[model samples]
Structure formats: structure tokens, C-alpha cells
Target chain A: MELTGAQILIKLLKEEGVKTIFGYPGGVVIDIYDELMKSDIRHILVRHEQGAVHAADGYARASGGVGVCLVTSGPGATNTVTGIASAYMDSIPLVVFTGQVPVHLIGNDAFQEVDIVGITRPCTKHNFLVKRTEDLAKTVKEAFHIARSGRPGPVLVDIPKNVSVTKIKYKAPGPVKMRSYNPTCNPNKRQLQKVLELIKAAERPVIFAGGGVILSKAPEELTKLAKRTQIPVTTTLMGLGAFPGTDPLWLGMIGMHGTYRANMSTAHCDLFLSVGVRFDDRVTGKTDTFASQAKIVHIDIDPTSIRKNIPVTVPVVGDCKCTLEELNRMLEGVDLGDLDKKRKPWLDQIQAWKDTKPLAYEQKDIIKPQYVVEKLYELTEGKAIITTEVGQNQMWAAQYYHFDKPNHFITSGGLGVMGFGLPAAIGAQLACPDHIVVDVAGDGSIQMNIQEMATAVQCNLPVKVVILNNGYLGMVRQWQQLFYDKRYACTCMEHAPDFVKLAEAYGASGFRATKPEEVESVLKKGLSTPGPVIMDFVVEKEECVYPMVPAGAPITEMLLV
Target chain B: MLDADKHVLSILVENQPGVLSRISGLFSGRGFNIESLCVAVTTDPTVSRVTLVTKADQMIIEQIKKQLNKLINVIKVHELTGSPFVEREMVLIKVHAKPEHRAEILRTVDIFRCKVVDVGAEHYTIEVTGTEEKLDAILSLLKPIGIKEIARTGVIALFREPK
Candidate 1:
């Protein structure tokens, strides 16, 4: 049957089980928007194109499905770039749709015409520009597949306005063959045997987990293997919820801003079983000096990631869940005799370090960031789905908050992108409606995508946004203070919008807290509110993210205040 | 580091505007200077194949592969190094020739297995197909008398067996 490109798009999304989309309509995408009006899929009208993309990102991360977004060309498409890059860096599955100029006037520089595919190429996993009406269905299907497949990332489909209006026979192709896109979900037997042997032979073995464990939902398997092997486990910032933070074997995050004990244990361990972790530069301060004493065994789903950052003694490329299962099975009868005795020295040293240089916040007249995070954790009882914006606030949330369940904490760890929390909070709330969704955002990051409050009000999604109003881009300002001698170029925002007024303008409840005593009350009020609420807490501007290991420094050389 | 042996690369990219810019940007950003870059549309209108030549060692080639794999529009990248590959280059040489030298030019073209595609009053455009070095030799032979203009189809190499 003949169908318009717009109809084909809607049908394709419906076939992919997409129930909702975040978008804004404009002249360029009027045909698609009109067709969408007749469809069953729900579309949330975002106040800005940036909000649409971030909301879609949040939806993808929370639901573990392809998040969809639609926008017009030019500024609409350009505005989504930051969000797209954020998702791309974190490997979130997102299918982004942007209206394009009519085919006839594509090269004429017509109104609202921009080269979106060109601009988004570096930031997306893949992109397509629909030239023919017949390719619409196939392109849309391929976009979803590529976005959700191996090492998931955002994909963009730029459909010309005229093509959307053109009618053509829509026949969705059965899966297209991509030879280069082979993703292995099973571990190689030889590699698994080698890793198992190394684990058994080593005296002190530690399991280093990352977000991949949570992405693959292998937390149960990871915990079981850790318990059976009696090995200590350390996680990266992204791997927060993969293992219980309160467990005895758990060493809370290890990195520049990680706990001193976690960093010390990771550095002193003999056998490092890195599972589902990328060993990002932030995690491995100096590549040459990172885990200098450990023999690394890296396991991940993507083959290319193996040994790409750090040299792996045994590289097993497969799904984390499957690999852990195989490893657990292989270690069933092996003898790990008195390995705990060998690890006692390392553990004792780490404990001593922790006792002396624990994660501490200075007692002051004003409320500390850690105190605010800890209070939020206590008030919510560690049951809330917490999302965080980038920089100091994100580190504080990760460092201070204790996560008890998997997929409970979402943050942009790899890309360190700001403006992720608010929209992601929206997506998380939509996914788990009964759960309390709290977005811990900073003043700088929240303002990046603050316009999403309109989406919150429109959908009546009660996402409690707690803005740590530090009056500056806390992370950049800290870097400037430490490295650039406090040049403070554009990091300081002396004149900024009143966040409380901004929230009220979006038809939502707003509150501000200047004192430590007011934080819990404001947060409770915001969370208990029927609709969306924003709480702006006046935080100290000059506060820095401590326990920072300068770039290329040894993890043991972390600077603590 | 430049290697003595040259490596041929075939990259499939989307047929979109500024895609070339993205490709070049990647090559330049990573300091992998392309020796030769040629782009042409494939049978599929939406796809284009770019053939590039670079004098890179094995390590640099691996780095290039990783960097190219990261590009969004780049569908596939293959390196035809030490492989049974069919390498070809097309060179159109316009040689200045009078009526007296026309027969000699024609004879020379016949001996080199080249074709005379266009013949003007004072110039003859001889199309030569061979390796880049072979084409260079042919151009050198034609340059002594008088050469007007030259156009070349940069090296496009394909492996004899599937990778």
C-alpha cells in the first residue's frame, strides 16, 4: 500500500513498540507532526528542542529502550546536539528525528535549512538523510536497530520535508546485513579459562565493576561471583548501583574523586578483574601508573574496547552477564586456598588510610555539599531514583549517596555532560512512577536544559529537582582555581535567573533554602508535592570537588582536603 | 611515521554534503595526513566510496582504523596492505602534438596499452590506466615534448578476497 513518508515514520515507530515521543513542531516538520496527530503514539511537546532530546535520552536510560525525539530543522536540530553528544558519550540508545528542507531547495539555502547530519556526525553512532520516500521505512528501522544495538548510542534521521509529503510504497526491510557491526554476547572459552586460571592463581583478586554490569543487568551475577570468590569489589562512578554500596566487599567508587580506601585497594591489588568497565582516563588517573601492581583482566561486550585504553592480560569480549556466568561456573571446583590471608596486608593498609583520610567535609556555618547529599539519602532512605547533573554536584551525589538497588542512580560519567539530571529525572519518573525521582543538579547544569519544566508541567510528572545553586560552573571554576590560578573567565555567573521564579513561571511549585535547617523541609515539600517542584539550595560557590587526582597522576597521589 | 610501503584504504561514507569535511577533519585531527583523497558516488545513490592513500606503518594504520571506525557517516573502512589487491589509477594526459607528431603519440599510446579519448587540433588527451607509478612514468614520457593539462582518478584498490 502506498503511504506518505510521515505515515511510514509513525508506523515504523509503532512497530518498534514506541508508545511516546518528545518533540516540538515547526513549519519544516508540519507534515510529520500532522501525521503524528492521527497516530496512537503520545507526543510530549517540549519547550525547546534541547529538552526534547534530553528527555528522550532520559527515557532510553531509564527504560532501557530506544528513546525517540522529533524536531524541525536549523536551530531545532542544532539545539539537540549537546543532548545527542551527551547520550552518545554515555552510549545511550536514542533515535533522533529532525525535519529537513524540501528536496528541491536543499542546496538553495532555503529558510530553516541546516546540515544536521553533517553537524551531528561526530556525536552520533550513525546517521541517515532520507533522499527518497521509498527509503523512509527501512531507514527508520535501521536507525532504531543501530541505536539499540552494540555499544548503544544515538542515531539521527534527517527527513526532507518534501519527502515526508511524498507518497511511496512502504515495505520495511527484514534486517539489513552489517558485517562491521558484529557484537559478541558470549565469551570466548579460551579467554574465560585463562581469566579463571589467573583468578585462581592470584593471591589478592579484586573485581572492578563498571556501568556495563548494570547495563547488562549482571549485578546479581557479579555479587554472586564476588561472594563465592571472597574478593573485594570496587566500582566506577557509573557502576554505583551495580553492587550494594553497603556490602562488606564493596569499595565504593575508585577514581580522581573516589574514596581514598577504594583507590588504595585498587592500586595495591594483585589481580584486577575489570568487568564491564572502560578504564576511562578519569578512573585510571595515569594510564602507565594505574593499578601498577595488578595484572588486569578486562571483560566487556564491545571487542574494540578491549586493550584500547589499558593493556589487558586477558581480554574477554562478551556480555557481562554471560561472561560472569561462565566465569562463575568455571570457578565452581577451583581451589582458592587462603587467598584472603595474602590480601590482609593490602586491606589493612587501605583501612589505615581510610581511618586517617576519610571522606570529610569541613564543619562550617553554611551547609556542605556532602551534608546535603547525605541528608537527601537519609530522607529518601536510599530508595529514590537519583539522577545528577555534571561536575561537583554529580561527584558529591555519587560519593555521598548510598545506592541499594541496581539502576537507581543515573549520571553522565564518561562524557561528564551537564544538564542531564532534570530531563533524565523526567524519564526515570515516567518509567517508575511510584518511585521518588530526584534530580540533583547544579546551577550551571540545570540552566542548560531548564526549559524542560514546561514538559514536566504538561505531563504532570512529579520530578523533584534539587538545584545546588553554587553561583558558578562549579567544576570548571574549580579547575580554574587549582590549575589556572583562579582566572575565572566565564565560570562565574554573577547575574543569573532566579530559579524559584523560573520554576513558578512553568506552573510548578518552587522553593529556596538558604540555611542548612531548611534543606530537609524544602526537599520533603518538593517530593511530596502532587506535581513537579523545584528547590534551589543556596550553596557555597567556591567549594571544590576534593580528593582530585590531577590528570596523569597516580591514583594514590589523590589530593584530599 | 612514514613507511616505505604504501597502504591503500577504501572507505564507504554517506553521500551527504560536508561528509568530506568530516572525513578530512578526522584525518587531520588525528594527524593521519591523507596522501590522496578521491570521492565518487556508488551505484547506490545514497552511498559514496572514498579511496585514500597513506604512507603509514602498521601501528599508525591500526590507529587510523580505530579513528575511522569512530566516524558516524563512515560505514566501513578497509586497509589493503600486503593483500592480493587489484590496484588501478586512471590518468588523462593532454599531450601537445602537431600533425607530424600525431602518429608517434598514437603509436606510443598503443604500445603502453593506453587509449586516446580526445584529440584536439594541437593536443591529444591520452587516457592511461595502471598503477600510480606507472601513470607517473607515462606522464613523464609525455611531458618532454609539451603537455597541456592532466587529470587523474586517484588510486582505488579492492581486495581480491573478501575480508
Candidate 2:
């Protein structure tokens, strides 16, 4: 049947099993939006174009499929840049559709014409501008394929206004196989043998997990390997849910703000089995001393991630799930005497470190931000899907909340994007309707895209936003206090809006907790509200995230508070 | 420690717009220096090959290749800096060649296997294609002849298969 480009887009999305889209339509995308109005595919009207993309990102993270979104031309297309870059940095799978000025007006600088493909080239995995109607289907197909395959990332497809109204002959296409883009999936047997040998022979072995394990859905395989070898597992900020956070072998997170045992174990381990981490600067401070004594084994789907930051003794380029599965299968037959007995001393040392310098914060006078996160964790029974905006709020949430499963803790790890949590919580709540979803946000970051609170109310997503009102840009303020002797440049947000009033204006219930006694009551009330709610807790203004390794300092030598 | 070394990088990429800008932008963004750059389409209509030379340490060399590989358009990257390779660069020199100085100019052109592509009343445009050193040597030999103008194509290289 001959169908308009908008009709074909709806058909394609349906064929791809996409049930919902987070978008804000404009003049150029009106046709697509009109078609959307009549389709069964629900469209969540986001308040801003950035929120649309980020909500889609959160949806994709919560659900293991390619997230989809739509936006308009000019400023609308440009507004999505931060979200696109954040998704790219974290390697999230997303396909963003943007409306463009009609084909003939693309270069004429027409009213709303912008070179979106050029703008997003550096960030997106791939992008396209469909000038003709016939190419729309294949481009859409290719965009989704590229977004989800190999190392996943965001892809954009810019459709002109005329193309949406043009007629096209549609024929469903099969899976795409780009000859130039095949990714290696299976780990090399020799490399697996080397990993096995190191694990068996090393007196102190530690497993460093990253986001790739969650992206590849390899938690079961990773758990099997960790259990079989009795190696302590520590995750990066993005890899929070790759292993059970409550496991005894779990050394907390590792990096600038990682736990004491996690950082110490990584610094002194004999063999470092790093699966899917890119050795980001934040994670491997002072590269020369990062795991200096260990024989580092790096396994990732992307070959470029290995040895790009730190040297690796054994590098395996393959899917995390595939590599871990094969490694576990191979280890099933190996006899390594009693693995737990051999690792006792190492585990004991790690336990001693954990006991020596446990993560602690003093809550006096004013309420602490960490206390809010800990209460949320306890109140939700460690089951609510937690998303966080960047800075002190994010680090505190990652530190206090223990996730027991994959896809539970979602945050912008690589990009450290503020204003991410509120919209992301909406997406997560939409993806898992039965589960409670909360955004642990800071006052400064929450205001960046505070408009998204309307989207939650409109969609009735029932996402709870827990704002730790610290009255400052907590992270940057901490840095200024530490490095610049408390100059307090522009990091203060002394006069912030009343969040409770803002929530009420958006037709959502709001609650505020000013003292320590009110934290739990406010949380309980907001969570049980059945509809979207915002809980604003007035937290300590001068609180600082602990276990900070100063810039250029080794991860081993942290300035623990 | 920035212990840098000169290395030649050959890459195969999609023959499309913005790719060159992306690669160059990456170099500038990462603070890696590019010594020379050249690009042209390969046998495949949809693909283009790029050649860029840069100076970097061993670690930075790996970084350059990995960053290049991360690009969606980049198909493959090959580092052929130390291998047995053949390189060619073409230079056109317009040197003053008076009637009395014709013999000397012709002799020099013959020795360099260069052709006098354009001949004016008092000048000759010599076109030479050879390795960078050979081109440099020819330019030196013609420099004292009151050279009027010169144009050169950036160097392109290929690995010389050993027997």
C-alpha cells in the first residue's frame, strides 16, 4: 500500500515492537504527530526537547530495547544535543527522530532549518538526513540496527517536513548486515585460558565491573564467574547493578568516590579482571598507579576501550555476556583445589579495609543528603528503580542505595549530566509500571530541566522526585571549597524556587521536609500518593561527598573524611 | 610524558561529507598533532581512503587509532609508519629557463625524470612524482634557477610487498 512518510514511520515503529514514544511535536513534525494521534503507539508529550531524548534514554535503560523519540527543527533539534551526548557517552541505545525544514529549504537557511546531522555527528553513533521519501524506511531500519548493535549508542534520523507528507512504496526489510561494521562477539580461547590461569594462580584477584555488563545483560554470567572463583566484585558508578549490591563478595563502587575496600583492593590486587570498564579518568586516577601491581585483564565489546587509558596484560574484544559465559563454561571443569580457602586471607584483608574506613556521614543540626538516600533505600526495601542527577546527589545515591538486580539503578555515568533524574524516572516508571521509581536529585541540578515535572503529571507516570535541597551546586561548591579555598564563585543557589509550590502548579502533589524528624514522614507520604509527587528535603548546605581522590591523585590515596 | 614520534596512519572510511572534519576535529580535540593529511576515494564507490601523518608516543599512537576507529564512518585503520613502504608526491615548479639556460634545465629535468609540462618564453613548469626526499632533492636542484612558482600534492603512501 502507498503510504505517507508519517504513516510509514508509525508502521515501522509498530513493527519494531515500540509501544511508546517520548516527544514534543512542532510545526515541522505536526504530520507525524497527527499520525501518532490515531495510532495505538502511545506518545508521552515531554515539556522540552531535551527531556524527550533523556526520557527515551531512561526508557531504553530500563527496558532492554532501543529507545525512540521525536522532535522538531532549529532550536528543537539543537536542544537535544546534551541528551544525545550523554546517551553517547554512556553507550545507551537510542534512535532520535528530528523534523527538518522541507528538503529545498535545508541549506537556504529557511525559518527553522538547522544542520542537525552536522551538529550531532561527533556524538551520535550515526545519523542521516532523508531528503527523499523512498529512503525513509531503509534509513529508519538502519538507524535502529546501528543504535542497538555492537557497542550501543544514540543514532539520529532527520526527516524533512515535505518527506513526512510525501508518498512512499513500503516494503519491510530484514536485518541489516553492514560488511564494514561487523563487531567481534566471542572471546578468543587463548585469552580465556590466560584469564583462567591468572585467576587460579593469583593470591589476590578482584573483578572490576562496569556498565558494559549491564548493557550486555551479563549479570548471571558475571555472578557465576564471581561465585565460582570467589573473587570480590567491585563496580564502577555505571555498573552498579551488574552484580548484587548486597553480596558479601561485593566491594562497593570503585573510582574517585569508591568505597575503601574497593579502591584498596583494586590498587593492590595480584590479578585485576576488569570486564567492560573503559578505565575512565574518574575511575583510574593517576593511571601510573592504578592497579599498578596487577596483571590487568580487560574484556569489552569495543576493542578501542582496551589499553586506551591503562595498559592491559590480556585484552579480550567481545561482548561482555558472551565472554563471561564462555569463561564460566571453561572454568566448570578446572580443579583449583578449594578456591574460597585460598582466597581467605585476601577476603579478610578486604574486610579489614571495609571495617577500617566505612562510608560515614555525620547528620547534625540540618538533615544530611546521604541520610535521605539511605532512608529511601530502606523505605523502598531496596527495590525502587533509582535514577539520579549528577553531582553530590548522584554520588550519594550510588553510595547508599544497594541494587540487587540489573536495570534498577540508572544514571548518566560517563557524561555526568545534571537534570537527568526527573525525566529519567518518568521513563523508568513508564517502562515498569508496577515498580516504584524515584529521582534522587540535588536542588541545583533539578532546576536545570524542572519543566519535565509537567510531563510526569500529564502522563500520570507516578514517578516520585526526591530533591535533596542543599541550597548550592553541591559538587562544584565542594571542589571550590577544597581547591580554591571556598571562593564560592557562581555555585550558590541561595534563592531557589519553592519546589512544593512548583509541583502544585503542575497539578502534582508536593511535600517538604525541613528537619531530620520530617524525612521519613515526608518520604512515606510522597511515595504513597498514587500519582506523580515531589518530596523536597532541606539537606545540609555544606555536606561533602567523602572518599574523594583529589585531581591527579592516585585512586589508592583518597582523602577520606 | 609526551615522548612523541612521527608515524603515518592510513585509514579506510566512508566516502561522505563531514568525515574529514570529524577526523580533523578529533585530532584537534585530543591535542594530537597532524603532520600531513590526504584523502581520495578508493575502488569502492561508497568508500574513501584517508592518509594522515602524525607524531605521538606509543600510547598516543594507540589512542589515535582507537579514536579513529570509534568514528561511525571509519571502516578500518592501518599504521604503516615503520614498514617497507613506497611514497609519492608530485611537485610542479615554474623555473626561469632562458634560451641560454635551456641545456642546464633540461639536464636537471632528465636526471630527475620530470617532465616540463608547461613551457613559457622564459620559464618551464617541471612536474615530478617521486618520494618526498626525491621531490625535495629536485626542488633543491631547481631552487637556484630563480624558480617563479611551485605547487605540491601531499604525500600518499603504500606498503611495498617484499619478495
Candidate 3:
């Protein structure tokens, strides 16, 4: 059938089963917006281009589908860079469409023209420029396929203005050919056997689960392996919800800011089965000394990530779910003789370490960040899905909140992007409407994408945003105080808008928690509200994330409070 | 050390305007030296293809591959020393003959599978198609008599099977 480029785009999206899209229309992309008006897909008009992309990212993360966003070129395309990068780092699937200049004026630097393909190359899985009207259908189909395929990532399609206006006979192609892309989901049998052998032979075996476990939805298998082998599990910051934190075998997070017991146990374990984790610097403090006492077995989907950071004794490259299934099968017949006998001494040492320094917070007139996090944990009974913004709030959430299930604790660990929580909470709430989706956001990070409050209000998404107001970029201030001799340049914001007023302006219920006693009541009120609500908790300004291993120091050499 | 099947290549490079000098300088800088060298561009255009015959073993060929990857805008390069490939050369011979022996020479041309593209009263331009050795044989056959002019198309090759 003869179709315009815009109509072809709508048709392609319809074929892909896309029900909704988030974007803001401008000069170049009006053709798409006009075509969208004639289609059945729901288009959400966001306040800003950044908010649009973030909302799309949120939708993708929550729905487990490719998030679609359409925007004009130049600033609209440039504004989506942060959101695209966030998804790229986290390996979320997203398909972004950008309107380009006319074909004739492409090289002449026409109005609203930018080389988006070149700018986004490193941050995307793959990208294409639709020069011909006939290529639109194929490009759009391929974009979604590439974005949602194995090891998912964002893909951009830049459509020229004239191409969108041109008429062409469009028939959706079956599939395009890509020679270099291959994603393996099943573990090699020999490698799986080696991992099983390592797990069976080791006396003190610890399963270090990361975000991949949650991403692959392998929590049940992980829990089964942990219970069957009687091996304790320690999670990275991103891997928090992969196993129940309340389980006796759960050792909590292990990293620079991890629990004392968890960190020490990880350092001392004989066999470290690192599953679905990249061993980021935050997790492995000093590379030379990290897991020095352990023999490493790494399982990951990406082969390049196997020995990229830390050397692995046994490298099993495959999907976490498939690998764990194979492991469960291998362990079904093997008798783990007297598992308690092997773990008794190690458990005693770990308990002793936990007893030595439990996660503690001092109660003072000024509300400490940890105290607020602990109070939230107490009030929610550890049932709420907690999403965190970057910096101090994220670290506090990681330190205090106990996640009970997979998908319970979502944070931007690899990207460390601020302004992630509010939109992510919106997406999470949309995904699990019955559950309480709480975004633990810092004041600085909250303002980055606070406009998402509009999205929440429009959708009536019941997301409770708890803003930890410290009056400074708390994490940066801590860095400056510790390393930069307290210069404190640009770290402190003298005149900040009242968050309660900001929340009110966005048409959401607002509350303030000033004293320690008010923390619970304020959070309860915010959580009890029918729709989106914001609670501005006045937190201590100078408090920092303790147990910080001075950037390059060993994890053992932590500076605890 | 050259392989038993290795062949020597002779290439003509244009000496005009430091082009030949630049080409030689490039070869030496990249640790590749020419075994045989010749110069001059033909009448058609203001360009030249430098021909350098080298004794490149397999390892040396690999090194040359690496160096060629670094060159900016070098049109084309290939190793013409393998089987299952076709190689052809063209030679134009202007032979002096009397009118009486013209018929006999034309008959010889037909017997040798050559074409006379240009014919003057005294000289005939006979074009022969064959291997370099066969072309040399034809040139040797005409050496006893006067030969006016000669021109040749360089050895170009194509793989027998599709690449």
C-alpha cells in the first residue's frame, strides 16, 4: 500500500504492539505527531524532552518491553542523551525516533538539524538514518527488534523531514540481516560442569548475586541454589532484591558501603560465585586485594565482561537464568555432606562481625539520613518497592532498607544517573499498581526531573516520592570536604525552592517531616494518599555515607563511623 | 626467505614531480623495500601505478597487509601468486614488413591468435593476448626484423570463483 513515512512509522509501531509512546512534538517531528493523531496509539505529551525520554525509560523498565519515544532534532535529540545513556548503562530496551532536516539540506546544517546518529553511536546498541521513504518501515521494525533482542539496549532512528513527507509503497520486511551480532543465552555444558564442581568442592562458598539475576528474573533459581547448597548469598547494590534480605543465609550487600559482616565474609570466602555482576569499583574497592582469599567463578551474559574487570578462575558466559537452571540440575543428585559442619565456623565469624558493628545511626535534633531510611523501613514493613535517586539518598537506601523480593529495590547503579527515582517510580507503579512504589530522592536529584510529577499527576500514578532535603548536593559536598579541602564550590545551594511548595505547584499532596518523631507520620500520610504525593524530609546536611573505602583503598581498609 | 612458489613482481612508478620518490619513501618507511622498480605514466592520464616486485613469503605478506591498512587512500593492492585465478596481459607490436610478405605475416598473425588493430603501408600494429612468457616469445619472434613501437597492458587478475 502507498503510505507516507509518518504513516509507515505509526503502522510499524502498531505491528510491534506498542500501546503507548512518550514524547513532545516540535517543528521537525510534527509530521510524526500529526500521523500519531490519526493512529490508535496513546501519546503522552511531557513537559520537557528530558522528561519524555525518562518516562519512556521508566515505562520500558517497568513493562519489560521496548520503550518508544519520538522527538524533533537539535535540542530535542540532545536532551534525550542523558535518558538514553541511563538505559544504555543499565541495558534497558528503548527505541527513540528523532526527526531530521530535509534530505537536500542535511549537509548544509539546516534549521533544527543535528547529527544525532553520530552523537548517540556510543550510547546505543545500533542506530540508522532513514534516507529513503521506502526504508522507513524496515528501519522502524529493525530498531524495535534490535532494542528488545538479547542484552537489550536503546536504538535510534533518524528520519529526515522530506523522507517523512514523501510517499512510497511500504511492505514490512520479514527480518534484516546482521552478521556481527550474536547473543548466547545458554551456558556451555563443560563450563557449567566446572562451576558445579567449584560449588560442590568449596568449604566456604558464597554466591555474589548482582543486577543480572533480577534482570533475568532468576530469583527463584538463585534462592533454590542458595537453600539447597546451604551457601550464604551476598548482593551488590543493584542485586539487593535478587534474594530475600530477611533470609538467614542472606549476608546483605558487599562493597565499599556494604555491611561489615557481608564485606568481611566476601573477602574471606574460599569460593566466590559471582553471578550477573560486573564487579564495579564501588563493589571491588582495591582490585588487587578484593576477594584475595577466594577463587572466583564469574557468570555473565556478556563475554567481554568476564575478565574485563576482575580475573575469573572459571568464566561461564551465558544468561543468568539458564546458567542457574543448569547448576540446579547438576546439584540435584550430588550430596552436599554435612553442609552445617562446613558453614558453622564461617557463620560464627560472620555473626561475630555483625555483632561487632551493626548498622547504627545516632539520634540527634537534626534528622540523620540513615534514621529517615530506617524509619521508612520500619513503617513500610519492608514491603514497598524502593527506587532511589543518585548520591547520598541512594547510599542510605542501600545501607538501611531491606529488600524482600526481586524487583523490590531498583536503583541506577552502573550509570549513577541522578533524577532516576521519580520517573522510575512512575514506571514501577504502572507495572505493579497494587504495590507501593516509593522514590527515595535527594533534593538535588529530585529537581533534575521533578517535572515527572506532571506525568504522575496526569496518569494518576500512585507513586510516593520521599525527598530527602539536605540543602546541598550532599555526596559532592562530602567529596569536597574529604578530598578538596572543603572548598565547597558549587556544591551548596543557598536559595533553594521549598519542596513542599514545588510539590503543591505540581498538583500533588505535599508534607514536611522536620523532627525525628514526624518522619513516620509524614511517610505514613504520603503513602496513604490515593494518588501521587511528595514528602520533604528535612535531613542532616553534613551527614555522609560512612564505611567509605577511600577511593582506591582495599575494602578491608574502610573508614567506618 | 622466499617460498618455493613465490613470484617476483616488477612495478613501474612515475618519476615525475616527486611521486616516485614519495612512493619509494612510503615502502621503506613501512619496512617494505622494492625488489624491482620502473617508472613512467602512460599517455592517457596524469597518474601512475607504482609497480614493485617483491619476494614476500607468507609472513611478509601478512606484515604488508598490516602496513597497507595504515596507508591513506591507496587505491588497490593484491598478491598475484596463487592458483585458481586468471591472469592476462596485452601487448601491441608494430612490425615492419615488405608488401610481398604482408599476406604471409597476416597468416602468421591468424595462426598465432593475434589481432592487427592498426595497419599502415609499411608497419602493422599486431596486438597479442597471452601470458607474460607468451608475449615475450612473440616479441622475440619479431626481434630479427625492425619493430617500430610497443605498448602493453599491465597484468590484471580476477579470481575464478566469486569472492
Best by TM-score: 2
Better of 1 and 2 by lDDT: 2
Please give the range of 10 consecutive residues that has the lowest summed lDDT in model 3 chain A.
Answer: A175-184
Question: Looking at model 1 chain A, which ten-residue stretch has the lowest summed lDDT?
Answer: A175-184
Candidate 2, A279-347: lDDT as tens digits: 999999999999999999999999889988899999999999999999998998999888768999999
DockQ score of candidate 1? 0.26
Docking class of 1: acceptable
Q: How many residue pairs clash in all the candidates, one count each?
A: 0, 0, 2
Candidate 1: deviation at residue B34, Å? 2.4
**lDDT winner among the candidates?**
2
In candidate 1, stretches whose alpha carbon ends up further than 4 angstroms from where it belongs are A168-180, B2-6, B10-31, B37-51, B57-59, B66-78, B83-152, B158-163
Tens digit of per-residue lDDT, candidate 3, span A1-561 = 888989888888999999888888888889889999988898877777777767677777666677888999889999888888888777778899998998888878788888887777657766788889987887788788778765677888999988889988877787755433446789999988888888878987889999788778788999999999988999998789889988999887888788887888888999999999888898998898988889899998866566756877998878999999999998999988888887788788888888887777798998888988888899889988898999989999988898888777877778888988887787677667788889999999998888889988998888998888999999999888888999898988787788888878988889999998898899888889888899999988888888677787788786678
First chain TM-score for all predictions: 0.95, 0.99, 0.96
RMSD of each: 3.9, 1.9, 12.3
**Residue A241 CA displacement from its true place in model 1, Å:** 1.6
Question: Better model by DockQ, 2 or 3?
Answer: 2
State which candidate has the highest DockQ.
2
